[model samples]
Target chain A: MTALPASTPRKMGLVIDLDTCVGCHACVTACKGWNTENYGAPLSDTDAYGADPVGTFLNRVHSYEVTPAEGTPFTVHFPKSCLHCEDAPCVTVCPTGASYKRAEDGIVLVNEDHCIGCGLCAWACPYGARELDAVAGVMKKCTLCVDRIYNETLPEVDRLPACVRTCPAGARHFGDLADPGSAVSRLVAERGGMDLMPEQGTRPVNKYLPPRPRDALTATPAATPADPSTEGLGGFLGWIDRTLARF
Target chain B: MHPAPSIILFTTISGLGLGLLAFLGIGMIEPTGLAAFLWFTLGYGLTLVGLASSAFHLGHPERALRAFTQWRTSWLSREAVLAAVAMLVLAPHAIGLIFFNRPLTGFGIIGGLLALQTVLATSMIYGQLRTVPRWNHWTTPTLFLISAITGGALLSGLPFLSQMLLAWLAVAMVLHWILGDSRFAASGSTLGSATGLGARGAVRQLEPPHTGTNYLLREMAYVVARRHVVPLRLIALLAACVLPSVLLWIAPFSLPAIAAAILLHILGMLTARWLFFAQAEHVVGLYYGVR
Candidate 1:
C-alpha cells in the first residue's frame, strides 16, 4: 500500500506564483487553521507561550533575498507545502501503510490509525513538508484541502484549498494539473513554471513561477548638482537669509 | 541528525548483538550446558534491549506492530520482519544446544543468514534516504556490515580474526568519514536549487518561516560544531579500533582480558555511532540555510 500508484486519474495540484506572493503568511495561517480542525490530527503547538515553542504546520512561508550580478537585490516570499509528487519518497519510506498517494486525485495523505510516528517519512521528504504533531503523535501534511475541495455543502466559490482561497494576491491556483486545458496548467505553461530541486526526481505536481526581472540598475543617470553661488536666492526665505547674514 | 541516544544505542548495540547471533547461527562455538545458556542469553538479551530502545523513539510506540506489515517496499518494515524471523528460527537451535547438547546446523544456518539480512535491512533504512546524502552512498551499508562482522568476531573470542577486522574497521571508518565529508556539497542542493531560483541569482534566507523552532528544524536542522568533529573522530578511531585491536593482540586469551577488550570496543563503537548520526546532513537544511 505504501507503493505509489503508477499514475493517477487526475493530478490535482497547485501552481504558486512567486512574483505575486506578498509574504503576508495569510495562506500559511489559513492552511493551519483549516487542517488543524478538519484533518487526520490537530496540529498542536507545544509550549505556545513559552520560550522554546514548537508546533506542527502543513504549510509555511519563507522569504529569500536574491542578489543578481547587475541588478538590485530583492526579497522573494516563498510559501512551501507538500507537492504530492508522482514518485513520493515519503509514502514509500513509511514503515506502516499509513502514508499513501490517492490513486483518484493524486493527493498524498496519511492514515493516522496505522502510523507509528517513526519520523522516517519526514526524513524522506526533501521539502520538509511533513511534520510530526507533538500532541497527536502523528505525521501531519498538506492534504490540498481534500474535504473542502469536494464538499457540496460549501458554496462553489468556497470549494478551494484554504491557502488558494485565502491568498489575497491570488498567487496560489489549484486545479487538475493533468489536464493541459486547466487554468493552472495554462498558467504554468505561460509563466515558465519550474520545479524545486528537479534533480531530486520527485516529479512534483506543484510548480513555481519565477519572479520577473526588474528594471536595470544602471538605467537612471546620476543627477547634476545645482550651482548655489552662481544663482542667488530670489525668494522670501532668501531675503531672510541675507538679513541674518548681514547681522 | 540530532544523535538521539535511543537510535545510537539501537544501531551500535543491536548491530553487535545481531552480529553475534550471525556467528553463533553458523555454529562457530558449539558450547553445551551453562556456556551455551550464557551465550544465547547474551545474544537475545542485547538484541531485545536494542529493539526496545528503538521502539522508544517512536511517537506511538504502542502501534509498533504495524511496522511489520509493509515489507514489500519499506526497509524499516523489512528489518522488523527479518529480525523476528531470525529470532524465531534460531530459538530451536539455541534450545537444542543448551538442553539436549546437540547442534541444529540447518536451523542455525537459516537463522544466521536471516540475522545478517536483518542487519542489512536496518542499515538500508538509513542508506535508502537520498535526502541525507552522506547516508545514501554504498559506503553506508559497507560500513554497517563491516562493523557487525568485526563486532561479531570480537564477541565470539576469535583473536586473530577480531584483530584483523578491528584494523579493517579503522580503515573503513576513516574512509567513510573522508568520503562523507564532501557528500552534502556534492549533492548540488544549494539554497538556489531548493527554492527554484538559481537561474535568477544567488539566494539567501532573509527571513525564516517562524520565529520559534518548529518540528522540521528541530528534527533536521541540527548543527554540530565543526571543531568537535576532529576530536570525536580521533576518539572513535582510537577507542573503537586501535586500542581494541592492540589490546586483543598483546593480551593473553583469558576471560577477563577478553571482557576488558569487549568493553573498550563497545565504548569505541558508541563514539563512532554517535559521530555517524551527528555528522549526517539532510538536504532539507538548505531551506533553513543551515547546511
Candidate 2:
C-alpha cells in the first residue's frame, strides 16, 4: 500500500498566496481546532497546562526575513504542511503499509492503527510535514482535512479545509489541482505559483504565490523639514501654500 | 540524524558478529568441537543482541515484526527479511558443527554469505536514504563490509588474513572519513534552496517556526562543532585500525592478543559509528537555517 498508485483520479491540494498572508495564525489555530476533534487520533499536547508546552500539530508557519540585494528587508510567513506530493517519499518508505496516498484524491495520509512509528516517514519528508505522536505511538501529518472536506453533513460552503475556511486574507485556496479549470488552478496560473524546493523532487501538489513587488512609495523615507523663516521669496509663497493646504 | 545509542550499538556490534561469521563460513577459522560451538555462539550473540537493541529503538517495539512485510519496497523490510534468513540458515549450520562434528559445509557457507548479505542490507538501510546526503554513498557499504571481515579475521586469529583485512579496513576507514568530510563540506542544500529564496541573494530567519524546540529540531537539527571532528577521527582511527592491526600482528605469538585487538577495534568502531550518525546532516535541517 505504501507503493503509490500509477494514477490518481484527482490531486486535491492547496495554493497559498504569500502576498496577502498577514501571518495572524488564524489558519494554524483553526487547523488545530478542527483536526483535534475530527480525526480519530487527536493531535495531543504532551503538557496542555504546564510550564513548557509542546504538542503535535499538522501545519506550522515559519517566519523568515528576506533581504533583497537592492531593497529593504521583509518577512515572509511560510506555512508548511504535507504537500501531498505526486511522488511522496513518506509513503514509499513506510515499512508497515501505514503511510499511504489515496488513489481517488492523492491525499497522503497515515493509518494510525497500522503505524509502528519508526519515524522513517518523518525522515523521508524534507518539508518536516510528518511528526511522530509520542502519546499515540504513530506518525501524524496534514490529512488535507479529509474528514471535514468529504463530510456531506456539513454545510456546502463550510466543507473546505479548516485552514482555507479561516484564512482572513483569503490567502489560502483549496481545490483539485489536477483539474486546470479549478479556482485554485486559475489562481496558480494568474499569480505564478511555485513549489517550496523543486530540487528535493517531491513534485508537490501545493503551490505558493510569491510576494508582490515592494514599492518605495509605500515604504516612504523620512521627510526633511524645510525652514521657511530663512529662504528667498519662494519660501513665503511655499509657506502660504502649505498654510492653505493645512486649512 | 539523532545519533541514537541503540542504532550505534546495533551497527557496530552486528558488524563485528557478522564479520566473525563470515570467516566461519569461508572455513578460515580452525576450531574443534566445543570451541567451534562457542565461536558460533558468540558471533550469533552479537548479531542478535545488536538487532534486538535496534528493535527496541522503535516507538512501538511490539510492531517491529510488521517491518518485514514490505521487503519489495522498503530497505528496512529488506534488512529484516535478509537478517531473518541469515539467522535461519545459521541455526542449522551451528547445530551441525556442535552436535555432528561437521566442518564448514554447503549450508555453513550459505549461512556465512547470508550473514554478510544481512550486514550489507543493514548498511543499505542508511546508504539508500536520499535525504541524508552524507550517508548516501558507496563508501558506506564498503566500510561496513571491510570492517565486518577484518573483525572476523581478527576473531579467527588468522595471522596473514587478519593482517591483510586489517590493512583493507584501515584504508576503507580513512577513505570513508575523507569522503564523508568532503560530502559535509559540499552539501547540496542551502538556506536559499531549502526555502525557495535563492533568487533573493540572501535570506535570514528573524523568527523560527516555534519558540521552543520541536520534534524536527530534536531529531534532525543536530550539529557537531568542527573543532571536535579531527581529533575524534584520529582517535577512532588509532583505536579501530592502527593499534588493532599492530596488536593483531603481536597476536600470532600471544594467545590473548587477538582479544585485545578485537576489544580495541570495537571501541574504535563505536566512536566511528557515533560520528557517522552525528555527522549525518539530514537535508531537512536546511529549513532551520542549518548547513
Candidate 3:
C-alpha cells in the first residue's frame, strides 16, 4: 500500500510563482490553521508560551538572496510544502502502510491510524516536507487539502486549498498538472517553471516559476541639476554665505 | 543526521551481536553444554538489548509489530523480518548444542546466512536514503559488513582472521571517511539548485523558515564540530582497528588481552558509528544553507 501508483488520473498540485510571493507567511498560517482544525491531527505546539516553542507545520516560507553575475542582488521569498512527487520515496520507504500516494489525484497522504511514527518517511524526503507531530505521535504532511478539494458543502470559490485561497499575493495556483491544457500546466509552460532538485528524480508534481530578472541602475552619466540661487537674502543665511565667500 | 544515542547503540551493538551469532552458528568456536549455553546466551542477549534500545527511538513502540508488514519495499521491515527469522532458525541449533552437545550444521548454516543478511539489511536502511548523499553509496554497506565481520572474527577467538580483518577494516574505515567527505560536494546539490535559482547566479539563504528550530532542522540539518573531526577519526581508527589488531598479534590467546581488545573495539566502533551519523550531510540542508 505504500508503493506509489504507476500513474495518476490527475496530478492535482500547486504552481507557485516565486516572482509574486511577498514572504508574508499568510499561506503558511492559513495552511496551519485549516489543517490543524480539520486534518488528521491538531498540529500541536509544545511550550507555546515558553522561551522555546516547537510545533509541527505542514508549510513554511523561506527567503533567499540571489546575486546575479551582471545585476544587483535581490531577495526572493520561497514558500515550501510537500510537492507530492510521482515517484515519492517517502511513501515507499515507510515500514508501515501508513504513508501513501493516491492514484486518483497523485496527492501524498499519511494514515495516522496505521503509522508507527518511525520517522523514516521524514528522513526519506529530500524537501523536508514531512514532520512528526510531537504530541500526536504520527507523521504529518501536506494533504493538498483532500477534504476540501472535493467538498461540495462549501461554495465553489471556497473549495480551493486554504493556502491558495488565502495567499494575499495570489502567488499560489492549484489545478490538475497532468492535463497539458490545464491552467496550472499552461502557467508552468509559459513561465518556464522548474522542479526543485530535479537530480533527486522525484518528478515533483508542483512547479516553481523562477523570479523574473530585476532592473539595475545603468552606468550612464545623468544631467546635473540647476544650482540653488542665493537670491533670497535672508538675514542669517546671507551673512553666512558672504562670510564663507571671503575665504 | 543527529546521531541519536539510541540509533548509534542499536546499529553498533546489533551489528556486533549479529556478527558473533553468525560465527557461533557456523561452529567457529566448538563449545558444548555450559560453554555453548553461555556463548549463545551472550549472543542473544546482546542482540536483544540492541534491538530493545531501538524501540525507545520510535514514537510508538507499542505498534512496532506493524513494522513487520512492509518488507516488500521497506528495508527496515526487511531487517526486522530477517533478524526475527535468523534468531528463530538459530534457536534449535543453540538448544541442540546446549542440551544434546550436538552442533546442527544444517540449521547453523542457514541461521548464519540469515544473520549476516540482517546486517546487510540494516546497512541498506541508511544506504537507501538518497537524501543523505554521504550514505547513498555501495561503500556504506561494505563498511557495515566489514565492521560486523571483523568484530565477529575477533569475538570468535580467531587470532589470524581477526588480525587480517582488522587490517582490512582499518583500510575500509579510512577509505569510507575519505569518500564520504566528498559525497555532498559530488552530489551536485547547492542552494541554487535546491531553490531552483541557479540561473540567476549564486543563491544563499537570507532567512530561514522560522526563527526557532523546527523538526527538519533538528533532525536533518545538524552541524558537528569541524575541529574535533580529525582527532575523533584518529581515536576511532586507533581504538577500533589498530589497538585491537596489536593485541591479537601480541597475545593471540591471553584472556586480559582479549578482554581489552573487545572493550577497545566496541569503544572504537561506537565512535565510528557516531561519526557515521554526525558527518552525514543531508541534501535538505542546502535549503537552509546549513552545510
Candidate 4:
C-alpha cells in the first residue's frame, strides 16, 4: 500500500440558519429516509398507519413563537437533533467500545457488530438522539451521512448530507468546521450563532443562528377603518338614521 | 436511564423473593393461617427462581462470584450475600414447616435479618450510584423499603390486602415517575455542584463538542416523549399496583386475589425498577454543556 502524507486533524460540522428555516420538516424527513436505510438497523414502526405508532426519527423540528423583550410576535422553528458533542458522555459510558469518535474527521459512530445491546449509550445521551432498535436489539442514531459524504462516486457539490441537500430554504450548511475560512465558521463568527443546551458541555459543533427581529422582516399592520357616522351623530335621531342606514 | 428489561426482572424478582421470605418468617412467629404460609412460600420460591434466571442477563456470569467480594463498597455484592443468607434460612424454615414438628423461632429470626439485609442491600445499589442524582437520594431507599414492606404485607395478608398493596404500589409508581422528571434547581451538592458558577438561571448550549453521536449521547440522550410517558406511566401504575390492590381488597381470602396480588406486585415492582433507571440523571449531564 502507498503511504499517504500525514495530515492534521479536521473538524467537520453543520451550521443551520434559524432565520431562513420555514419549519418545512424536509430535513427531518430526508434524515429519517436516509438513516432508516443506512444505519445499523431500520427505524421500524410498530404500528404505522394505525393507532399508537412508535418508531425512531433521527431529526425533529420544534416551532416556538417567541415574543421578545420588545413584545413583538414571531415564530422560530427550531430543528433539534443530535449536536455531536466533542466531550460526548455517551461514548465514555459505553461498557462496550461500540460507541466511538473518529480521530480523523471528528465523526462519532457506533460499530454495530460490536454492540451488545446494553442501551448504556441511550442512557448517557441528553439530546434524545439515540434510539434502541428493539427488534435488532441495538442502538441507532444519525451518522451525518458518513457513507455519502466520503464517497468518491458522488460529485463534490453533492457530498453534503441528505438533510442538507433537501432543505428547501437553504438553512442547513455542511463543511469543515476547523478551517476559519470555511462558510460555516464565517457565518457562525459573523452572526453570533448559538448551540442548543450549551451548558450541557458536550461542545456541540452545530450552530443555530438566532432569528432576525420581527420588525426587520415584516411590514407594520395598517390602522382599522373608522365608523364615519359614529362621530357625527349623538342623539336619538342619529340612532334612527344609523338604524335606517343599517337596514 | 431506560430500564433495561434484564435489570427490571432482576430487581423485581429479587425484591419479591426477599420480601415474601421476610413475611413468611414473620407469619411463623404469629401463626397465620395455612393458606398464608402456602402463598408466602410459593411467592418466595417463584421470586427466587426468577431472580436466579435473571443472572443469565449479566455479561460475565462466572464473575458473579467476584461480585460478593465488593460487599464493603458495592450494594450489589451485599444483595447477593443477603440473598444467599435468606435462602439458607428459608430452606431450614421451610423444612421445619414440612418435616419437623418444631416451631421456626430460631430460623425465623435469621430469616428476618436476611430479609432486612436484602432490602437494605437493594436500596444501596441505586443509592450508591452518585452519578445518578435521582437514584442517589433517600427516596431510593424509601422506594426499596416500600417495595419490601408492601410485597411482604400483601403476601402476609394474602387474599385480603393483596389488592390494597397493589393499589399503593401503583400510586407509588406514579409518584416515582413524576419525581423522576422534576428538575431540582442545581444545588451545591448535585450536577450543579461541579461548576459552582451559580447564576440561578437556565443554562442553554452555546456550543457542543462534535458533529456526530458519541457514547454519552447514545446512552443519556434517550427521551420518553410527553404523550407516551403519561399513558405508559398509567399502564405501569394500573397493571403493577392499582388493579392488584383493588382485587385483593374486595376479595380478600380468595385464592385468585392472592394470586393476582403476587402477579401485580411483581409487575409493578418491575415497572418501578424500569422507571428507577429511566428517570435517573447522571452527573455526566453536567458535561453535556448544561448548567
Index of the highest-lDDT prediction: 3
Per-residue lDDT, model 3, residue A244, is 85
- Candidate 1 docks at the CAPRI level of high
Instruction: Evaluate all candidate structures by whole-model CA lDDT and list the values in order.
Output: 0.90, 0.83, 0.91, 0.63
Model 4 agreement with the true structure over B144-170: per-residue lDDT tens digits:
766776777766665544455555555
Off by over 4 Å in 4: A1-8, A216-230, A233-247, B1-7, B14-291
User: In lDDT terms, how accurate is model 2?
Assistant: 0.83
The candidates' DockQ values read 0.84, 0.58, 0.80, 0.03
Ordered list by DockQ, greatest first: 1, 3, 2, 4
Error of 3 at A22 (Å): 0.8
Clashing pairs in 2: none
Worst 10 residues of 1 chain B by lDDT: B218-227
Please write out the lDDT profile of model 4 over residues A103-182, one tens digit for every residue: 77767677776665545455455555676664665677778789789979889876788889899999998878778999
> Which residue pairs collide in model 3, if any?
none
What value does the lDDT take at residue B132 in candidate 4? 58
| Candidate 2 docking classification | medium
> Where does candidate 1 stray beyond 4 Å?
A223-247
- Give the interface RMSD values of the models in order: 0.7, 1.4, 0.7, 11.0
TM-score of each: 0.96, 0.92, 0.96, 0.56
**Where is the poorest 10-residue window by lDDT in model 1 chain A?**
A222-231
Query: In model 4, what lDDT does residue B116 have?
Result: 64
